[model samples]
Target: MQSQQLWTVRWLNAIGDVDREQWDKLALPLSTPLLEWQWLHDLEASGSISPRYGWQPYHLTLWDHEELIGAAPFYLKSHSGGEFVFDHWLAQLASEYGIDYYPKLVGMSPATPSVGYRFLMAEGVDKQVLFRNMLSAIDNSCQQQQLSGCHFNFIDELWFAQFPAHDFASWKHQSYLWKNQDFEVFEDYLQTFKSSQRRNIIRERRSMSKQGITIRPLNGQEIGTDMAALMYRYYLNTNERFGPWAARFLNGDFFTRLFQNYRHRLLIIAAYTDSAAPPIALSMLLVKDGHLIGRYWGAETQVKDLHFNMCFYAPIEWAINNNIKTFDPGAGSPHKIARGFRAVANTSLHRLYDPRLKILFEQIIDQANDMESANIKALNQQLPFAKNTRPV
Candidate 1:
């Protein structure tokens, strides 16, 4: 009998060294282009998430004698933007108590909230040892650099299941997720809702269509320079609409490389003005196999029901047309429930240094998860669905 032996921590400048095949090998959940080597590298290459913008990539990797064991996307964040969870209160508490919160470690897929975050490790390795060592590395770095605790947001249920004993707290959040049961057509989808809500969604689409706004679901290859440029404009406009976190992640070049490298996984659905098909609103999503992910969307002009048509209806139609399975419209907005997205549990894992803070956040999040589960049940009951016709 013996210990698995000593481990070493390393940093990856390029995702190439991280072995995509191995990542896929250890991967338990569905992968996205955003989490892939090419996409993450493009983000760094195109200056999306970098130290220059306060997101220093300090990706910690654990190797058990030269074989990659555990790794997580660790970023030294100056500010929180792409992170969907709001932690200003924690930061403010840190500030009010004269503590520094910036430069905290974040374990998440940057600029995207498609959950499935965990420190990917091989099966033979001791999960506890692997995570402890990984956390040990980050803790040392935090102490040396005078930073705050780690925040792991938007992860999966499996990771959450195994984290509590490690003093890691669970953060609960509700997001939109549509299941593709036996649905084969758009009408089949409409059949789930009560007639009134169904009529509203139908009328919403009709109004946008009658307004002469045509939505074209374009793949990355089919995306022209004009539409790409318009997307950036919309990104800018959306940023203004929201405030801080809305700032663009990648400058235009990232998208340029994006459109070039991983064109197949992308679906840019564009809505345009009739004068010459100039786009007014658009959505950018990643499509894999039979799943259509709702990524980013924005409009140049504020048209009524435009967001509904372009973001939800258009993609759902495409999903039905292609027979795609699940549609994960990215996190936020409870309004998504009425639009056909169901209550789905999204998970994330965390580790903290101060035992008191660890206990506090743990209790807080445990209570929160309980409350959220109950609330979602209540929300489900309120959905406009005929008796026994609900899509659960």
Candidate 2:
């Protein structure tokens, strides 16, 4: 491994400090769009992920002279609000031990529950070397600051294995992922389900049309500020409906900025009652390199089966036509299984600087992971696939 001293390590107060072109050079090649420079920058510039909201931007960068080599987008979180990985139990444990858990360093796309998170390393560089040095830098920062620990959530599966060697324990969580099985059309996808589920899905998709509703995917230049503003209204409405469980992290400004700057990666699955009328409901999604992530949804009023059709069926249909490889229907809801989303493992790696907290984490991490694995297995077992084609 190369010495950590070879690279000049810098911790950024905000992503905007880094050049957009340089940041995208490392982030663009990644499979996940959440880590893209524009996304992170907008999150900060819009105040959705600011100190007032408990997420303080503290990105890490590795530079070789004036050239950027590696970057890890991190946050100094005062509370675990937007992070989808529920660590409240771990926080309680820390409290029991008199450990200050808040203000800990965390790495992940703010408010995004999808996977594929790892160090954004420049091409042609020694990835393993960069990975090691970055890990070392995080460890040093945590220890020097006397913070509770550092965690990397919804980590890329390929990078999950590398952390254990560097003393980071892995915590397993389950997320729903729909893989394209060479589905040529929406019906081809429907055929994967058992006859009972196939009938149910068909009914659900039809329910929308019966109510004089039509769903269509609008991408790139097709999106406008009015639609973006309406989508934010729906986002707020959706979050309000969830009440206590709502993850209403993004504000209206964030959505407006997203449409303004990141429209190329945006895909809004909109429901319309008339061809000339405005959409009554909208489900916003992000796409990059054939990977789709269902982000948010809102409806002007309650409509039967409208949620499933617009968010799932319509998006799935569009994905098939576009040759998208995977569709991550955001976080939450085991009910997605009935719609053919299989339960897959999502991992978060942790390193507690305090010896007591670290020991407790190591002691229970295996048992916790075992239980989670069993739960995921049970969930997949309930998948309505005709031949049980769950991922191995």
Maximum-TM-score candidate: 2
Model 1 lDDT-worst window of ten: 24-33
Local accuracy by lDDT, each model: 0.75, 0.89
Model 1, TM vs. native = 0.86
Question: What lDDT would candidate 2 get against the real structure?
Answer: 0.89
Q: Tell me each candidate's TM-score.
A: 0.86, 0.96
In model 2, the runs with Cα more than 4 Å from the true position are: 1-6, 160-164, 388-392
Once fitted onto the true fold, the runs of candidate 1 whose alpha carbons sit more than 4 angstroms away are 1-7, 13-29, 64-67, 122-132, 143-146, 159-165, 243-248, 273-278
- What does candidate 1's lDDT look like per residue over 174-253, in tens digits? 67688776777889889888899999999998997688777888885687755666777776777688775454676777
